[model samples]
Target chain A: MKACKLFRAGDRPVLVDEDAALTPLCSGDEREDRQFGKGLHKEIAALQEMLYAEHQRKVLLVLQGVDCAGKDGTVHQLFRKINPMGLRPVRFDVPTVAETARDFLWRVHLQVPRKGEIAVFNRSHYEDVLHPIVYDRIDGPEAGCRYAQIRDFERTLAESGTTIVKVFLHISKDEQRRRLQDRIDDPEKHWKFDPEDLKHREKWSEYHAAYEKAIAETDAAHAPWYIVPADSKPHRDIAVAALLAETMRGMSLAFPAGDPKLAKLRVK
Target chain B: MKACKLFRAGDRPVLVDEDAALTPLCSGDEREDRQFGKGLHKEIAALQEMLYAEHQRKVLLVLQGVDCAGKDGTVHQLFRKINPMGLRPVRFDVPTVAETARDFLWRVHLQVPRKGEIAVFNRSHYEDVLHPIVYDRIDGPEAGCRYAQIRDFERTLAESGTTIVKVFLHISKDEQRRRLQDRIDDPEKHWKFDPEDLKHREKWSEYHAAYEKAIAETDAAHAPWYIVPADSKPHRDIAVAALLAETMRGMSLAFPAGDPKLAKLRVK
Candidate 1:
């Protein structure tokens, strides 16, 4: 199977074959996969220590996608290996009265990871652009301003040393239908479904358009958006793990040599 | 030097001599502490997997405290070790119209950790008893209702397998005054001080009374409050880590073990 090319759009939505056989990424390469996973886990663990010790770098992971796109599952599975001490996940919903009065980003900014900490936004600041554009909550001209505001906000965050990785979990509508149906058919899974999900499903095309535009406008060198295929859970997990591992590896962190004076002390 | 004793009402707060000679907890004696911190980290990691694999469990960590009491430092230091995936830290603030209109715990309940994930609230539901009671935001018989509501809410969480660990980072007023001065005098630490903190400092007695009442009323076996001495950062970190570790060790977990068919293929 051919490797899936990373999607980069100019004016249109980039189409991907949802059912295309996933090129065996880190899978067949078990040693590499295990090494990568273990190493990434260790590095994250250490990064967590650095975050605590120095409190210097703030990290944010933003996941945006359509229903059944595997945002929740991907986060649970891939991050399962991380220590809880350093992990924080924030899910954004409709703003409350106080939040609405502040700049759309205020509530979000307050939640940004402090230096050395990792904060995940299950759906994040992008919602300002995506929701407004899709729901006609803002006009095209207004949406343009919102998009720029988002870029500037993210730019400020990046400048402050926040490594932002935005993942757009791309899944075909057919797959969404199948997963939604699976939730509906299984009694135990019924809790996962919401009727409102269908309403959002009905406006699939609009959301897709909104997402494409949002990605195009905000994709930056500092905070790039990766459109990852989500048809296969294991494949998506492996791909995300690989992407995260690569990102951390690029950071080139060194574990602090223990304080020589403190290290020598025998506490008995 | 003796181990720090509990503070009684109408008495001076207990103070531990920072440089006093003392026996260190042995590696074997500290196994519970080591296991607690390591185990909690592992539990959180497992939960992250459960979040991904099964998408069950929303976890919430609520930290409530007085000024200079080390909420920021504890969260900064302790959670620094967890995996960043599927973890979120939410810092609760003064109630807005939407929050005020809802029951006291409404916003707190909304932020509960989802299955297989964890959410940390810098200050949480107990604030219903703490802030309101302290500031006269809620009073008289109504405050009684609020306390009962918090207990019920936490009980419901416990029944549903939501583990709640409430930590009160206890510090004496004298220590708070000293820390506040340190923040003011040290150029590098000046950013941490807010003039508004002085205003809260003035109301210290009222806040303490509120806290004592809240702790006495709401400390349940399911979600008991752990009061860690905040004057010593290392001691606090070690104690909190040990407590969290013990909590996770008690919650026995088993890895997915992979599919039996997949396991067979792996052997070849």
Candidate 2:
């Protein structure tokens, strides 16, 4: 099955129905599957080079997941073969003092991929909806307004020749607990360990509910969302690569045909 | 001699006195020099990773040169081994309608590197001063104002824990003519060929004078300018890498110390 269809969150997606451990695209042999994932990444890189040379369209990949759901790992894996010149990976942290002064989407709009570029957002404007809704900072009506604003914003980008791919890295509560425990156990990774993560984990159900609501309300044909099971890192990497490669392939990008008049021009 | 001292644009820089073809840092062997350049890039990549892990200070590299001076090539070579997650390479083109509406520095300010990030500008705010002066769009008084504004702007960034390294990729007029001609001759490179390059070539002396004025006025200890000889691509790569590596080494970046309180805490 095509990854787009295989992982697509249909009209109504229940968080409980998706199995985070399922690896439908994997060939069952771990080594072979890893190689397959690498191959897909190479393909994505080649396609990106063409898109850059074509210099016409833009590609934006949004990765959203609970902590330790492998958003960073997935990005590292996906772009291993790609040239940094053509890639823009943006990690949106908490809003700065200046950012809070402006509209929520203002900073985001500033970072959208320019023509002939591929931009990956580690966490994105989606955080605006997810965090506020989970923390009860914004009321339901305000949340609805933000969702409409996001839909309009994304539609504007799609209209301007940007292909948007939004992926939700789904991991089970058990998987999250194990990953959190590993971070706590390792001294080197203690820098990445935040006490606030425990507080957030306590509200896992609420956050999941928030994610479901955000995905359901804002998912559109132009900016499709994929719920990739991310319990296993390699599986998550493979799934994200397949989905992205498939997406870029659909763009049908090619290098520009040169001017015939320049064919005979020689360097002095 | 240290690259910092060797390429430093002194108090009174005469562009004519600088030899763009000089390879003072090279070992007089082509292959060895290329390998040495690669080694410096790796060292830079490692330093950048530490800087990202430190998550405190910021680094900004600004490249300014006439057309076909290999700005893009410098960036590509400098970042081949560095992770894109820690790198932000911004290419500033002509301002759009929205950008034109604001003060020149407004758009440039928005793209400054975030904490723990290294941002490289292929062409930068210097263009704001250089282009206008060369074209007579901004008069001497206005140019002086912009130059002072640039100095103040860079000082602000430096005070806020951003180490700025500005480099001029100095290529001879003959070298640029050959590069421009090569772009015109190769159909594959036709997409990069802009006819305006020939128009700009006619005003080479004006552009050089503008650059000299801008550098002399804005150069500071906080945001020092390096006049790198760039007639040979390998020489340019080596000088940039060495200067940047030296700058970062002075930062003393390292992984954050693990929290003592988390020593006994378990994830469960």
Candidate 3:
């Protein structure tokens, strides 16, 4: 709950320090922070129920990170208490042939949360800007155009009853190396280890620059981007949980009122 | 597991007698059945991991039943042991405007299991046939055409290394009435109950007939339809789990052989 620079909320998106691997929110006691996060998950679940009951607005949590930045793991832990019906976690991998034919946002727009729902994009439209820019698939001008499009798309969503929270899971190059190494060392997790990830690992600095540019260009008052330090898995989980809890509470969601006549009527 | 009629693997899909409410799989011992189901879940999970490790095939479990037939509950109980990374549970509610824009199978196709994945469709494209026919929204000839289309769609999927297992969760009218009443009685569960279900309840017999005609018309060696008595929720869960286990075992899924080079590779 302390002031954490990682919890950035402003119109001008700030660049995260490359070495910003420190967990500012850590209570310095692992068990204490774990317990606190456990309680926060329950609170978020309760708040989600109220949001669903309110049945008017929606929440969209966009999670972006480099490979092994714990976006998937954070989702698995942060959403344990939430109802799967209300919480839609969509992991967008490489776009299909059909998806490629359309604008990048076309597929993403299809998955946005409807009324009284929470949708978490595991890796989102941000990938379009980051990957194309990093791989030289698109030049600087095209990437800028996409950043503007994303800003407008998110601004429209925010204007039309959606609370948007974007998080950049900032993990160090060394940490990512260790995580990828862990996957390679465990044969059970071999399905998750992609050879393409090593190709991306070779361009970590370029990716870091891509992410920084994407965040700075698209960040807005309506769509605030938080850079969460994710070097420590436990810290990453709790920090993201806190960020979600804080975002939901800021919406001031409450359960809808019932019809007074319904109180008098009993079901047959 | 003693010769449950639910596991119909024959090329000709048989009609589920409208009055068939018997839970043949139940060993007449609820506790024992629960314990047995508990064990089967772990086996299914292990097989799923191997399926992922093999990364050469996919499994698609299509669950179809009338309102309050426990499709959602069965999915929750059945795949609990399986890693969610591999288990994709898609509940096909009434299609939206965008979905209706394309052929019925277009949206369904988008959600099919990829290689090394297990996708469960709560209520699949079969709804396209059943609902229209039951309400006379489509005539007999048109219904037949749609059935043929589904058969082709599924055959294509099965030919491409996808294991397709379709299970009809058969619950009695009395059982559905009780379940609906339970939802009505519990305020907390009222969200799960829909008013439209009562209208559908009146046409239950017609829907069953529609299902029989569609299944018989579409059943092929590549795609077999099973009718699982679902009056007992626990029994329904276990039976579906068993059906999935049987299907995967038949596929002879095994982990890919360990690379000789990986045995010597070390991670720092």
Candidate 4:
């Protein structure tokens, strides 16, 4: 039933609730979390193979979240088993002089998947709405225009056979504080922590409101968004992977048929 | 002694003979290959960390070879230990409508590594010269201009702190025939055996001369070419891994220093 609900979002917009969005999937059930994670990985791997062999459709996965939302870990663990050849993950950061000179979507457009490819955007063009609007980088009319542009750009890509799946890894303020502190204490992970993260955290409510508005406005039939709980790493992996696998399993894919004469030869 | 000579490409543009070029270090011996691979992996990992932490220099690795010359195998083995976060491998194929419209370097410039990253071009801008020259796709002034553009483009990248390492995997005609036939005989590998490869094989002498000329013309102090003997997979892997590790070892890098007061804070 949960899996079915996940698939129902297909090519349809769904607004996520800000208050209840951080609901942990396995708050009271460790057993269920572990089982789901293991099963989802196998299913995702199979789905990935089908996508690769078909080589007709493209999948774009967008991961957006606050600091310590486990975006990187979720990607590394869930897609670890898939053949690296078919997977391309692009992480968006502060735009360079070259990127800023162009439209906000210019850098994002270059990373879009070609046919038979799966591309994951660690952070995406949505940042134009989420970050700039919240940080007051642009005023009302400008922000509104950029939002419409992103939605239209995504629509064009979908018409061209790109399947856009957006996921928001939602984490609570308390959890963010806990995770940031852990990074400070852990020597190996110290490199990941930055004081600037705290500056962003100070404007937590602003980011949350921006994200909520973006999800509600832009989540459309061509590109839908999924709000995944990010409190537990294993649960987050299972939920995200399960959603992707369920989405891909519904697609039509056929392997390329090799030459009949050549097919019979078995390498010894 | 071996480490110093490993990075030195001599005054020549390309090392035409494997035995003579690699005289500084013993190769082809199985024991030496194993030792070379292991040591090189460790050193390269360190270099990768420095490059990433310092976030200043960008490195590009270009691999070109005949089919079955072990390009795929070498990339897998050499980068097996490198941090995926710091490594970006771009494999170019037939041009798309978007790519074909621009200058030959347009698609490639998009994939260049950011500061403190390593980008590997499986078959790179060199394809403009290698493929076109081999197939008579272009000739006369057009071919000459393409070749000159490639050299100038690479020189500019190098001057901008992008370390360029070009490797041409060299396998004898007999060895290539043996490997291609092996792929044909194996069902799992049959997909890799392209009939078009045989077309290129028929013009081996022409390809060889074209490659020789391209290497000579393009190789410079900033971007040197390594003519790796790929008759043996293990030997090829060792040489490549060693060359990469030796290059990284030469770059001096220091870890990012964090504030001591902040580092001492414990938040529970």
Candidate 5:
């Protein structure tokens, strides 16, 4: 199935059920599936080079997922073959005092990808909608204002030459439990485990609802959201790669044609 | 020769000359030299992972060179095996109106590497001093004041856990002429060529004088300058990689030790 259609969160409010994340989207062979994923990654690298050479447009990939939904892993997998020169991966942690003092979009706006660049946000302004609502810090009207602001922000990015692709890595609660357990069990992986994750896990359903509302309200043709099944790490990588390759293919990216007069210009 | 000592710009005024740029600093075989360079690049990649995990200090690599001096090429080579998540390659162009309105270091200070990040500045605030002084826009006393300001700026970063490594890619005028000609001859590379490079070439002596003066004034124990000979691309890459690997080795970066109490905690 084409991931674009299968994973596209259209007008309907997208729901995350336990069984959906466990669905095997790839051919069952893990090794072959990883090879296929690598091919898609190579395609992304090629397209990104063209995007850099074209030097007229930009791409922003927003990876939003709950704790242990594989946002960081997906980014590492996607960029294994990509050049760091043009790829910017920004991880948004809790905002500082200065960030809170300004409008919510202030810091996010400062990091939009420049022309001929691709920027990936590990988590994004969507946090302002998700966390605050889950904690009862902001109510319905405040959320309505934020959703509208986000739509406007993304529209500005789109209107100005940036192609926006936002992905939600959908993982089942059971898978998250296994991942969290694995982190706690491995001494070396302890750094990845945060005690706060458990608190967030307790309110999974609330977070899911917030995600659904945010996606439904902010989704647009200019800035579409892809809901990728991410219970299986390999499947998550492949789906994101397929979605990005297809998005870039539609951009018609190419190297700029050289000026004809430059053929005769001497350097010395 | 230890690359640190060989390339170090010491107290005596460092001059750029054709003979110095042509000096052979590597093993004779080009293939063998590149293999060695790759090993150094890999070392940098490995050290960078630890640096990222350490998450306390930052590294800023400032690359200043004349037109066609391989600043961009060096960055690409150095990061071929490095993770993009922790690497930020910032290319500073002619400042926009907003940038010019502020203090010269305002935009630069904003782009300094954050904790755990390795930011490579393709061209840097040094341009603020070099270009202005070369064009007679800033007189001798003003240049001196700006130099002191830069030293103060760099000292603040150093004191606050930034390891600064400034490199000057010293290329001969003859080598630059050949590289510029090659760019003009290759249709695929025409996009990289700028007409204004020729205007800078005409005033190479003036630019060199400005560089010499700037380096002399800003050179500090914490923020030292390394003059890497760059007539041969492979030698230049090898020198830069070696310099970086050694610098990171001195940093004593390691993964943070996980909390001992967390070892007994079970994930549910």
Candidate 6:
């Protein structure tokens, strides 16, 4: 459970399972869980203040999940109480003409939070690998290299004062079907409903496999991946928030003393 | 003093005075000031955590002063209690051949803190402007253009989510003489006694004029300059820490929320 010490890169089959949902923080009662989550939000907010006061490191939340698995929804729920000035929510859609001109990480590096900041990426550089591998635009060998590159990139970020928390929202296929059907049933949601979602749904299993491969290859202590049981929306938010709060607390953040000698000095 | 609202760029004469040492945070009691500094350090660290959690903006502490002005010591004392994991102390020295080949800011931009990281420059790009002008490597009109370029660079950084805190550690000429004499008297500290220090001391007035010009040209609402009274070291540290703590608090950092619907979910 202490991921900073135990997380290591593992093979795809060992690291990610297609049919598993781990609801670690679930209380089995929606109301109780909601109450606990509210408290956690307050605690998270306090921890965030310490992180800002310390202003020496960064935290990045990487949210990657299948469409309608609630990536965008998770971001909205987790950050509603937090001050908007400090949180930058970057939703990486398709690569733009300029973004594709360079390495995928060029744009990613540009978006990474500086010290005393937190950045949540709705979809991230992981998409490049996931899409290419799923669509067969990249071969297994090339995909393997990309994974290695990602691992190195992540480690570099971690080593350079970034606490990276990557969460993979795990939703059941049935949940996805319901979510997609609900989107179609409501006219107000039509704008968010892309026809491409249905086409991409056809290759869900392939995308899942691609995810497993990439996550397994890149998983490491510096940047740990969490597989949240997102089949239940309440469970997903609480679990992820709990994980973040715990990770932040472990950092041992404190206010810096400037001139401890000046600790008792009378300035004139 | 609401700095953000009132910090307008002024002319060199009004903004910077070579002979004045401003002890802005002084309360006239050393013990009381020290106690307050201790409390402020704790507050500053807490604010740092919030900044990191909010992770939307960056804070840059650009420390500039004459030689023997306690830049290194200031960085050490200010960050003594901070989590080293979140802080990056980047000392910018003479440019290397590769760095000189590129534009001046190319190397500087590379060292700028990413979102959520505090980058403390012991001496900074400001050195390029100061030394060159004093040494006459660049004439008045050229120096003026350099100042314009610096203004543009700082503005771009500010507009792009960087909160810059520039500190000019103001010390007396007599203090430099005493510090240099102490260094020479102690053979044990010979390694730190650079012959170049004496040469730079001879150009003290020119260096002060250069700093005054550069600061005046670059100070703005988004990136304000603090003139700290380094003649009184304790006052200097306490004032700077207080300023930084106040600046960070103004950022209003907090943890973010996502998907309000997930707030009341019952998980099993």
Q: Write model 3 residue lDDT over A1-268, tens digit each, in one string.
A: 4433457845454445454478777889989988999998899888998887777999999999888898867887787666554666777989999999999999999999888888899999999989888899999789889998998899889999999989988888778878888877777666667778888988877898887778888777678888888898888888888888988988998765443333333322
Rank candidates by DockQ, best first.
5, 2, 3, 4, 1, 6
Model 2 TM-score relative to the real fold: 0.88
Using lDDT as the measure, the top candidate is: 2
Query: B116-173, model 6: which lDDT tens digit per residue?
Result: 7677877888988899999989998988888888889889988988888988887888
TM-score top scorer: 5
Q: Write the per-residue lDDT of candidate 1 for residues B128-190, one digit (tens) a residue.
A: 677667777877688889888888989999888777777677777777777877766554444
Backbone clash pairs in model 6 (N, Cα, C under 3 Å; residues 3+ apart or in different chains), count: 65
Better of 2 and 6 by TM-score: 2
Query: A176-255, model 2: which lDDT tens digit per residue?
Result: 88998888887778777778989899989999899888999988999998999998888899999999999999999877
Give the CA lDDT, 0 to 100, for residue B138 in model 1: 74
Give the TM-score comparing model 5 with the true structure, all chains together.
Answer: 0.92
DockQ, prediction 3: 0.18
Candidate 1's TM-score reads 0.58
Model 3 Cα lDDT, one tens digit per residue, B1-268: 4333446735554445453467677788989998889888889988998987887899999999898899877876786566555667677888999999999999999999988888888899999999999888999788878888898899999999999889888888878888887776656656656677888988877887887787788767678788787888877888888888888878887767545455544433
Candidate 3 structure lDDT = 0.80
Model 4: DockQ vs. true structure = 0.17
* Chain B TM, every candidate: 0.78, 0.97, 0.94, 0.89, 0.96, 0.89
Tell me which of candidates 1 and 5 scores higher on lDDT.
Answer: 5
Each prediction's total of clashing residue pairs, residues at least 3 apart in sequence or on different chains, is 31, 0, 0, 3, 0, 65
**Per-residue lDDT over A1-86 for candidate 5, one digit per residue giving the tens place of the 0 to 100 score:** 77787789976756666644654558988888988888998899889988998898999999999999999788878887776778
lDDT (Cα, tens digit) per residue for candidate 4, span A64-125: 88888887777767665554456776789889999999998999998899777888888889
Docking class of 3: incorrect
Q: What is the lDDT of candidate 2?
A: 0.89
Local accuracy by lDDT, each model: 0.66, 0.89, 0.80, 0.75, 0.88, 0.73
DockQ of candidates 1 onward, in order?
Answer: 0.10, 0.42, 0.18, 0.17, 0.52, 0.03
Identify the runs in model 1 with alpha carbons over 4 angstroms from their true place: A1-13, A17-39, A51-54, A257-268, B1-268
- The Cα error of candidate 1 at residue B155, in Å, is 12
Q: What is the lDDT of residue A82 in candidate 5?
A: 78
